[model samples]
Target: MLVLSLSTVAFLGLAQLADASGSPSTGHRRRTAGGGQAMNLVRSAPNSNEWSTQQWGHWAKTQKSSLEAKYGGAGASGTGVQKRATGTNYMTNQNGDSSYFGSLAIGTPPVSYNVILDTGSADLWLAGSDCTTGCSGVATFDPSSSSTFRNESSPFSITYGSGQAAGFLSQDVVQMAGFEVQNQIFAVCEQVSGGLLTAPVSGLLGLAFQTIASSRAPPFWETLVTEGAWDEPVMAFQLTRYLNVSGVQTLEPGGSFSMGFANSSLYTGDIDYVNLPVTGSYWVLPITSISVQNQSISPPSGQQAYAAIDTGTTLVGGPSSYIAQIFQQIPGSAPGTGDFESYYTYPCDTDVTVALSFGGRTWSISPADFRLARLTQRECLGAFFEIDSGGSSAPSWIVGDTFLKNVYSVFRYSPASVGFANLSAVALAQNGDASGAVPSATIGSSAARVSATGSMLPKAHRSAGIKIGCGLLYATSASLLITIAVAGVHSVLL
Candidate 1:
């Protein structure tokens, strides 16, 4: 099926600055040597059946058309909004369906709010009391209820594939995992429309650099580093996936987020670090090659080859022409019918190996991760899809979680680099099984019930059982009940 995206326009202006400096802006602080915290990252949409390939196909088509119209030009030098992951994770219900979610706290007394930890956009926002559309059935934040709330009076607005949010800037105490940052900057959405109400999600927590942040404020992770919350200056993610005894695809609990430090225990071997361009937005990287089973495919050259490493997006998207080459290699794969022209279908059991090359290293994606879903018992959709790049101004690809899941990833703010390592047995658990020993839940206990639209914010604290050694507070939670409410597809499926 197709995919949707969150688009940003500011990254265009920042690319030039980065090209000259050989590095991104150095305003961010370096992590203390060997000091950092860890947090568990959960699937934003825990209920997977709430989404459909058909629905995703429709969303992808609409998003492509929107991009073409918005950025199409000859030799357009400005950075066009490629794909905004919108900072969402998905999970599934019974029968192998999926959605992903995470938890955070806001305001005084630390009211818990469920959020999608997105690496796409760089903003943190939640629905406020003033939101009229797509605000029902979900939790909302009331400024009056927060003791630390402060209004900046600056208006804010954001656009996504299926919806839009408009609100005002505000400041309050924000706590993620367990680390608390007082007077953190965020947005209060007063109005929302389109597909936001489809799922049970409170809001999105952007994990990208502050350059692309709408508030132009330091994102939560950056602030955490600046404050020396951890012993190291790195944030690591270990995403887990599994094939259950019933052959049902499921997300395991091994997924985690480590702040201020990269846990060597989670990954095997050395982390090959790569320079991520300071695009003033997403973690943009250069691509040297792409192939499937040793068959190389040529991606769009020049500006198009700069790919964005986004965890918010569910699919790997790029120009339709390039995607066609990859799809052609899959047996039984053919053009999708009706609404999903950009998508392709293949046999569910097809054995395929997709490899992506960057920074002189090739990372491979197995058939299990590349296969999006089983349309029937025999037909399946591929996770890699075509995204119109408006000729050439857009990015060559938006590397989503489909690729990120296979590796233990580290996103560093200062020097702006992205690193990847092979997921080890210690990091992903035995054979991708989550039934082993449970880590001690590190979430702190705090009680304050605010509005819950699609999912309730659990008042209990959780952790992943990682010790900071430096005696710093770790944000890794061992037990976090996350309910991801995706708007567009959820509305259609539910």
Candidate 2:
């Protein structure tokens, strides 16, 4: 994520004004041209634009070094931990208009805006008063009266997997979890094109590293860091699937946003860190090999594709060629007869495993993770199609919840490393110590059973043709269990 210096002159002017009369100004030096001071009178003028530009250049270098030291070195070797806790929470309704779903009573009653937690792209934007009928059931964020609102009128636009939106920039007093983010720069999309307006979500809360943010705007994460609200420079997440019926839509204020160092007891061993390519502004993880059902398939050479470890995306997407090769490996897999390009279908009950190799580690995914949920019966549908051939040339993959549920994922932006720890290993290590260990139970109508002894050894669990290795043992019921294992450390069940 190379951050190009935007306008050297503009930055220099700002820095000069900020440092005026503060110190002796000892380090400030004049630039010489042709082995002589170019226009000695102008060059010596401290407030001249050229003089300020030189000062800015010196300060910019210092700022970069300071930022690196505070955040971490550039690329995957840097280390930082998320200041907040990470855990799974449920949405209340599917109708996309609810902005404030849950409320938190702090100095004033704070509302938990129904924000789409996205990791694919970095930007924290919400709907403003300019939003009209697009929001059906959600509350709109009105910035007109906020004392902190700063209307820049800067034009902004964002395109997503489904659609795009264009709007103007404005500053507002944004509050979350009792924390006030003052004069935060946000986008107010007056008009949105794409069906996203109809989804159950109201706005998007980007949680990705600040490196991959809109070129025109500073990211919400950066604002938080600049405000000194958090001590750590990293953030972590743990997403759970198939919560109890009563737990669905459980959006109460101050619920939980778990983040901390990886729990050692939750995994069988230490977490593995892998290096990735940091080119341009994206972090690209090279795929050493991709296999299905244990058979390896070769992808096009010199065609390195970067994948964003996105928790918001529900399905995995990648280059069409790569996806085709993967689906071809499945015994009964075939292309769908429709406009969809890379979509393929296989026998409903066929057992398959998709394995992806990255950074010397091979992470295998279960068929259930690849299967799409059908509108009826709630059964596994099929593998998600990756459409990368059209206007989109970037061979990127968005690894969603299906693949994430099996591992505990640690997203350390400070070091730019993604760590995976298998959940099965964690569950078995803590089976029954009166510390919320998972119990042996059966999930689904199938006769599959999950047995854990609460130890660091591996345990097996089977349900509906899906076989999982449980490592961490915490709590269990008829269909689900709170177990921990490596891959990061996650609770797993049906």
Report lDDT per candidate: 0.50, 0.35
Off by over 4 Å in 2: 1-109, 159-162, 177-180, 198-200, 209-212, 225-231, 243-268, 299-301, 374-380, 389-393, 424-494
TM-score of 1: 0.72
**Cand. 2 Cα-lDDT:** 0.35
lDDT of 2 at 472: 11
Q: Pick the candidate with the highest TM-score.
A: 1
Choose the strongest candidate by lDDT.
1
Candidate 2 minimal-lDDT segment of 10 residues: 37-46
CA lDDT of 431 in candidate 2? 16
Candidate 2 lDDT tens digits, 1-494: 11110000000000010011011011331112111100000000012112222232332232222111111211111112223221122112111101111111101122233443344434455545576534433345566545445666455554322223556656554433223343445556665532333222335544444444442234444454433333343333333332111222211111112122343333444566666566333334666678888898884444445554544333455566788888887776776533333456677567678887666678887665565432122222354455332223233454544465456566555566667766545333321112221111111110111111111111222111111110111111111211111000000100
Instruction: Evaluate residue 485 in candidate 1 and report its C-alpha lDDT on the 0 to 100 scale.
Output: 23
